[model samples]
Target: MSTDDADHPLTRAELRARRAAEEAAAGVEAAAPEDSEPAEPSEAAAPRASTAADAPEAPQVPAVPTADEPVTRSAAPEQVFDDTPGPRRTPNAGSGTSASTADAAPAQAEAEFPDVAPAPAAAAATRVHQEDPPLVPDDAHVEEPPADPQLAPPTDPRLEPPEWQPHPTPAPVARRRRFPLVLGAVIGALVLVVAAFGVITLLQGPRVSSVKIDAQSAIDASGTRMIITASQPLAKVDPKQVSVSPKAPFTVDTSGRNLGIRFTVPLDDDTTYTVTVKDATGTDKQRQSTLQATFQTPKSTIFLLQRNADGDDTIFLTDLGGKNAVPVVQHEKIDDFRATADHLVVATEKGGTSVLLVMDRKGKNQRELKLPGPGFLSNLQVSERGNLVGYTFTDKGISATSGRASILVSQSLTGDGEPQIVTVGDKMPSIAQWAFVPDSSSALFIDFSGALYVEDRSDAKAKPTALGAAQTVEGISRGTYTAIVSRGNDLVELNLADGSEKPLAASTPDFGVPGTIAPFPGGTLRQVATRDATGLPTGQIVTRVDDDGKATKLFSVTGSDAIMQACPSPSGQYSAIVVAPKLVNNPYDQSLLPLPTTMQTHIVDTKTGKELVVLAGFDPSWCAQAPHR
Candidate 1:
């Protein structure tokens, strides 16, 4: 785990010195000098005599003393003649040298060299040199020398050259510390190898926790039993320390090897959730992620207002419930009309030509819901499934082609033609502005004036027939198909069996009315959440009717600004809006003057009309990211 410590500063000189020292100490060994020749004993005799003369008398070396110490010589013999190195002619040995030097030199030369005695010296000087007898028999000679306490007789002449030789370097002193050095080097190498392997292993490992889901690939409602899988052990995470948000009320199942959780919600709706894992110390590797069948709940009032900018009718998709104003589409020439969803779709002019563009709910392009030849579709209707599309347009030579539209009924595998007329109807509906019921026998249509119509296309081979105006529209929910409808502020409901209308409630000035209706799968189209006469949200309350047909407020908007366009969060608990000022100097000016300074996106807890988050300059589109596996 340790490298060079980087916490402290090291100067360049210090670093270099440290590196050099490390290198020098890495590989240490004993070194020897080149020469290995042995010297003749006489070579030491001269130095011995000279050293005795020059060196002061040394105190007698201490010895293991007996009761009576043995007599020790004050002056010792210097050397034997064999220990002598260079030519030593003794002519001046007696004359030039002192008498004591003469005496000690001869004795030392004889004792140390062991070859300067008269007989041997005389024979060696007079006779020709010859080899000595072999010490061992040729046939019985041993491979190795016999062990003896004493050293070998001088060195054998057989091993020595018959010439003067330089002094042999003494055998290098055996370094006893060598073993530790070798051991240390080996350990260092091993440590580096292991460290490198560990680093490589760690670098290649994944940093994010893997999450897997068991059982159903999709969740249909809350309280669905499910499992969230993890790659590591679950014990590392403490449930008490962990936090799962969106707080949609759910029970976590931490008993298994992998972390699994169960969900419970008041309303049965699809939701996506996040589960955060923390240790007992409230710390975690990072935040763990998972998703389930959950959606955003729009429990507040939001709006969008079409603004005029750059001589164009700019349509903004927003949550005007607060200080948010997001211009969905802006153009100087094109008429900016809006379509609703997590993603936006619009019909605008590009290069003086009318083109159908299906932008993201935020007015960003996905695929252009394009069509050929258009004066620009005046009315465009998209089905809840986003499959059925209907629009009205005027082509060349067509004078106010009032209600020319096409529906997807014919193209779908399951659809009966719901229309035969190619023109607008005075009262009965015209063109292809209706969606045939699932049975393909009857159809439902929303007129330009926001009136609901039931059409009978059972006799599709013949002319289609109108089922007449719906008897009661009071609280007639698009989500529940059970809401009361109002006729000039007179609210009523219809008895399905008899088709008879009954008034539910009389008009009340305090209760705001509905404008247009949009359909939801199994929920109610609660209310008309918008601005009132004061340019502030007064009718900014959600009105929902229960099974008892009693309508009441589900949530309220407490914002001051009038709501323009309201887009519900996917879960329907939050709303995003675009706000507009009450007055406009020029509705169609090429340059918008003095626009709202803060054009940010606002998010609020729809249940309380309490603001949650505000993101500046960023308009969020409902782009869903689901678990891949």
Candidate 2:
């Protein structure tokens, strides 16, 4: 409307280029404009000049045309057209105007209209008409999708993502080798198994460790035994493999791992014995070894009690060879006395009551033994192994044979305890003969009726069991199982365990009656068999017998002199026999008691029939395992 509102006019070349671009979008080839002549600019085509005083008001613009309608120039503003072809505008040749120049002429008139500004509605319509579709290059090619085994149908282009891609599969990882690890584990297990097996095998092998003997010196004289212990269970050993240096016959205990070697005969005193066992094997014979033991036997000795007519009775310690007699003790009136390894026990009588005295082996430190009552004591016997002293005592005023008189009682010399009375049925029985069962607290006693019994003196209230009737119990084995008894003219061994009887030895015409029998450590037995002449036995014979009934005559004396008692030495190598002339003789039952005036004791060898010594003593008590050796 004002002079300042005027804008620049469009050129014919610019309008032609815009028409080509529109033609390309409709899939039509745009033709180049023919260059003929230029047309004169119409008055309406020129930009109008206006003065501020003569300026006119602007005119209202027409509404834009939609795609459904065709557009036509109103002769006053720009027109819009639809897709449908209407009238074609050919270039006028006479006017020499091109189609592009004709189109620009109208656009220039729209700028010159002073009262009308270019409408926004017409501009938008022209842009839509000139818009072109996207171009595709002739050389550009689209790649086809690869084939998939399990293919999915194509999705709608509007729903599918623009930048979608296929996922890649990961490569497989390499596997690790396991051969070395498995082999190592197996080898480790085998090593453990082999180690365990070797340990077990070593434990199963047999070995001999050590040997044991009774004593370093003065080994048991009777039959010294050697104990051999093995590390494992043992089998029966070959006799040829066992030997002793002194060349003595021996028996072996093959029932256990511990081997027991027992020499059958007495070993020489003060001698060394070497034993060897080769090829000692286990019970399964899987292992073998050798064993050896050395033992020495000391010289044996004995103690004897000698009575003087006008003085006191003296106790003498002498060797088994009957040499080196030394006075150990002296008492005014000794009825019976016994010696032990360390002390001497004596039964001395004063007035009517009997007293027991204990003193060291040298006769020092004399102490009086407490009596149960003021009574007369007899049959005083000392147990060499148990250190116990046993005696028969009569209560004051009670007669010796009265049934209620003497009772068998025992007391320990080293142990402290009241005197234990050997009682039966709550009362002491009339024990005529009683002795300590060797190496035990029990006693083997014979009543006045000659009925034998065994009572355990450890319990004062223990009852006595009857062991049947016997003529006389010579001696019981240290094992307490076998007893040598006198039955008429035969000396039989009674098995105290089962009450069975077996003949051991008998008196022959040369030997009258078997008086006292003594058992050695190795089951050998020796007895004094008296020979009778003129219906009264006066001669005596000392014979040794074995379990097989083999007899050996050790000593034989023929005359008025008789063998009162035969005491075997502790080593069983010697015998102390009381020899005296028979004062009163009743042939069948001769009294062998010494006349008290003239009695002698003879020490004789049990192996040989040689007499060692004769001493002026009646009762001979060994001081070795017994009272003497």
Candidate no. 2 TM-score: 0.56
List residue ranges in candidate 1 displaced over 4 A. 1-308, 311-330, 334-344, 350-353, 359-372, 381-389, 394-444, 447-468, 471-567, 576-604, 611-629
| Local accuracy of candidate 1 as per-residue lDDT tens digits, 202-289 | 4433122345442221222233444554433344444465455555445566543445555442221234455555432102333333
Write one digit per residue (lDDT tens) for candidate 2, span 274-303: 888888877778666777777776776667
Task: Give, for candidate 2, the lowest lDDT window spanning 10 residues.
Answer: 65-74
Over the full model, what C-alpha lDDT does candidate 1 score relative to the true structure?
0.36
Pairs that clash in candidate 2: 218-298, 221-571, 512-530, 512-531, 532-537, 536-587, 622-627, 622-628, 623-627, 623-628
Regions of candidate 2 where Cα sits further than 4 Å from its true position: 1-268, 281-287, 399-403, 486-491, 505-510, 521-538, 581-595, 623-629
**Worst window of 10 by summed lDDT in candidate 1:** 64-73
Model 2 misses residue 181 by how many Å?
43
**Candidate 2: Cα lDDT at 514:** 51
lDDT scores in order: 0.36, 0.58
lDDT of 2: 0.58
